[model samples]
Target: MLDLTTGAVLWCALTGLLFTGLWLWYDRRDHARLAALRHRATFHCIRCGNLYAAPRAEEPAPCPKCGHENTRLKF
Candidate 1:
């Protein structure tokens, strides 16, 4: 009993809503993972040999010991 125009509009609206929900979910999950990574401590500066903490493997945290830019070091 639905008209073509109405059906198209409804379908578009539903698709938009579905995409929005998916985006929100993905963002939330990503934020949670980043938060967890931030709390972890695992990095060191090769130049100064100073130890530092970073949340993730790609973070660019500096060393507090020698004031040098640090890279992530695996423990």
Candidate 2:
């Protein structure tokens, strides 16, 4: 038979571990999603040399600084 205080401590430790594991899982998932988005949407302006992001790899990634319609280069 477990003591009352020991049981309470065990419950608290289990809850804390559960929450921490959940947080880490969420954080890793978000990081992967963000990384994929970053790799897809990355671009650089040819005119002003400014880096920017676009929704898709289509043409005319407009530069916010110089207003240039930059095209995405194929790798």
Question: What lDDT would candidate 2 get against the real structure?
Answer: 0.83
Give the alpha carbon lDDT tens digit for every residue of 5-46 in model 1.
999999999999999999999999999888876677687688
Q: Write one digit per residue (lDDT tens) for candidate 2, span 1-75.
A: 999999999999999999999999999999988985775566689888998777674557788899888876657
lDDT values for all models = 0.78, 0.83
lDDT for position 58 in model 1 = 47
Candidate 2, superposed: residue stretches over 4 Å from native? 39-75
Off by over 4 Å in 1: 39-75
Best by lDDT: 2
Clashing pairs in model 2, backbone N/Cα/C closer than 3 A: none
Instruction: Give the TM-score of each candidate.
Output: 0.54, 0.53
